[model samples]
Target chain A: MDPINFVILAAILFAIGSAAVLLRRNAIIAFMGVELMLNAANLSLVSFSRIHGEIDGQVMAFFVMVVAAAEVVVGLAIIIAVFRARQTISLDEPSELKG
Target chain B: MVNPLLFWIIAALTVIPSLSLLFARKAVHVAMAIVLVMVGLAAAYVALGAPFLGVVQIVVYTGAVMMLFLFVLMLVGVDQREDLKETIKGQRWIGLLAAGGLGAFLVSVVARVALPVQEETVGEPDVIAEVLFQRYVLVIEVLGFLLITAAVGALVLTHAPRLKPRRTQLEVQRDRVRVGANPVNKPMPGVYARHNALDVPALDPEGQPIEDSVSRVLKIRHQTQDGAEFRAQLEDPARKDTEEGR
Candidate 1:
C-alpha cells in the first residue's frame, strides 16, 4: 500500500472519530468513536511501518489492541454499573465524577 | 501507485460507517456502525500488509468487544427513547467550535504540509513474528499479563454480587397480592382466558370452574373484624339478574 494514501485516509478517520467523541453525549457511543480514533492511529502506525520497512509499528498495533480490549471490557462494565446506579449513561449525567 | 479503484472503494466503506455512527439516532445503530467501521479498518489493515493485525483486529475487536458493547446496549435497553438530554450547557456550540477549529487547523496544515514519499517492503507474518518474539519478548510477556489481568478483572467485575436491592415496597406488595389470591374462592382464568372459559389454569389461584358454565365465575369471601363472614360468587343467576337489571 502507498503510505501517503493510507496516511490521508487514516487522518480523515481520526478527525471524524475525534469529532464524534467530542460531540456525542452517550458514553458508549463516545467510547466507540474513541475506538475509531484508535483504529485510525493503528492504521497510521502500520502504514508508517510499511513505509520504513520495519515491524515496530505492527508490534505497537498489537499493544494498542491489547490496551483497547482491556479498556473496553473494564470500561464498559464500569459504565454499566454506573448507569444502573445513576439511571443514565450519558456523559453529562456523570459530571459529579469530574473532580 | 496504489490501485485508485480499490482505494476509493475501501475509503467509501470506512467512511460510510464512521459517519453512520455520528448520525444514527438509536444507540444500537450507533453500536452497529462502530462494528462496521472496525471491520472496514481491519480490511484496510490487511490491505496495508499487516495481515496478522488485520485478523486480530477483526477477531478481538469487531467480533468480541463490539458485541459486548451491543449486548450491554441491548441489556440496558438503550434505544432511541433512552437518549438522555445533553446535560452540559453550551456543549453543542463548544463541540462545534472545537471541531471547526480542528478542521480549520487540519486544512491549513494540509495546505502547507507535504508528506515525504517512501517505498514499502511488505513482510510475511512469520518474519514479523520472529522480530516480535525475539526482539520484543518482554513486551509480549507484559502484554500477556495485561490480557490476563483484563480477563480476570472483567470476569470479577461482571460477576461480583451486585448489591442485591431489597425488593421495593411496591414490588413486595404486588408479589404478596398475587400470592394471596386464595385457591378455593374461584378459578382464575388461564393466561389465555378467551381460549378456555372452563379450562382453568393448572396453576390457577382459585378452584376449578363447573363444567358447561358459559360465563366465568369468581368467588370472593371477605371476613369482617366482628367475625361476620359473607361470600360473593359469580353465578348464572347473579349474572343474569345483574345483566337484566342493567
Candidate 2:
C-alpha cells in the first residue's frame, strides 16, 4: 500500500478543520479547529517522512506539536479572559476587536 | 506500507467524530468527539511508523490539550447556549459553501500530484533523536523558551487586577454588626434534642421555631419539616387521645 493515501487523508482532515474554523461560532471550538488543522499538517509531515525514508519530517511534526501546545495555552487563556469580561464565549460576542 | 483495513478503520474513527465538530450542538459533546478524533489520529500516527509521535499525540492531545479545553468549557459555563442567530446575514450558508469549495480544491490538488512511494520507513526514536539533537537542537532550546513564555503569558493574560482593597476580618465583622447582623455565628439548622435533619429548624429559647436556622435552599424547595409540628406532638395531649390527629 502506498503511503500517499495518508497524505490524502491529511488533506481531507485539513479541509474539515478549515471548515470547522470557518463555520463554528464558539471560540474554543474554533481553537479546536486550529488544532485539527495542525494535526492534519503533522500527518502529512509524517506521511512524507515515510515516503522519503527520512526522520526529519517526524522531527518537524514534533516541533509542531510543541508549538501547538504552547499556542493552545495562550489562546485558551485569552478566551478565558474574554469570557470573564463578556460572560460569553461566542465568537460573535466580541465585535470590538473586529477588523 | 500501512494496511488498507487499518486506514479505513482510522478514517472512520477520525472522520465520523470530526463531523461532530460541525454538527454537535453541545460544546461538551463536541469536546468528547474531538477526544475520540485525537485518539484515532494517534492510531494513525502509530500505523504510519511514528510510534513516538503516536504516544506523544495521546499524552499531549487527549491527556493535556483536551483536558484544558474541557476545563475552559466548564469555566465558561456548560449550558452557555451558542448564540446561533446570524449577526451577519447568510453567514452560515456562505461558510458552508466556502468550505465545500475549499475541500473540493484541496482534493483536486492533492489527487493531481503524483509522488514516488518508497519502502516502509519506521521512525525509530534513535534516528529521530539524532536529527533532533544534532540538527534541531537550537529549535529545541527555542521551544523550551517559547513554552516558558507561553506559561507566563497565560498567567499575565488571565490575571485579574485587584479592583478594590481587600476587606480585613475586623472590617467585615464591623460591617456585619453595622448592618444589624448577628456578630456571632447564626444558629445552625436542626434541633439537637429532636430530629437532626437539616430541614428541621432549631428551637429558640422561647420554644419558637427559628426559621432562619434552616437552609434557605430547603425552604425554597418546600422540603422543610415543621419544627412546630414536632413540638406540638410533644405538647399535645389531644393528638395522643384523638385518632384524627397527626
Each prediction's DockQ?
0.53, 0.78
- Each model's C-alpha lDDT? 0.73, 0.88
In candidate 2, stretches whose alpha carbon ends up further than 4 angstroms from where it belongs are: B190-194, B205-207, B227-246
Model 2 scores a TM of: 0.91
lDDT of 1 by residue, B40-139 (tens): 7887777777888888999998889889988888877775253445566777678767765775676456446455645555546787788889998998
Q: What is the lDDT of residue B172 in candidate 2?
A: 89
**Which residue runs of candidate 1 sit more than 4 Å off their true CA positions?**
B80-86, B107-119, B160-179, B183-246
Q: How well does candidate 2 match the true structure, expressed as C-alpha RMSD?
A: 3.0
Model no. 2, DockQ: 0.78
lDDT of 2 by residue, B144-238 (tens): 99999999999999999999999999998899899899777778887567577889887788978788898998889999987667768768888
Error of 1 at B54 (Å): 1.8
Error of 2 at B87 (Å): 1.6
lDDT of predicted model 1: 0.73
- TM-score per model for chain B alone? 0.64, 0.87
Local accuracy of candidate 2 as per-residue lDDT tens digits, A1-99: 677878788888888888888889999888888898899899999989888877888999999999999999999999999988989888988889877
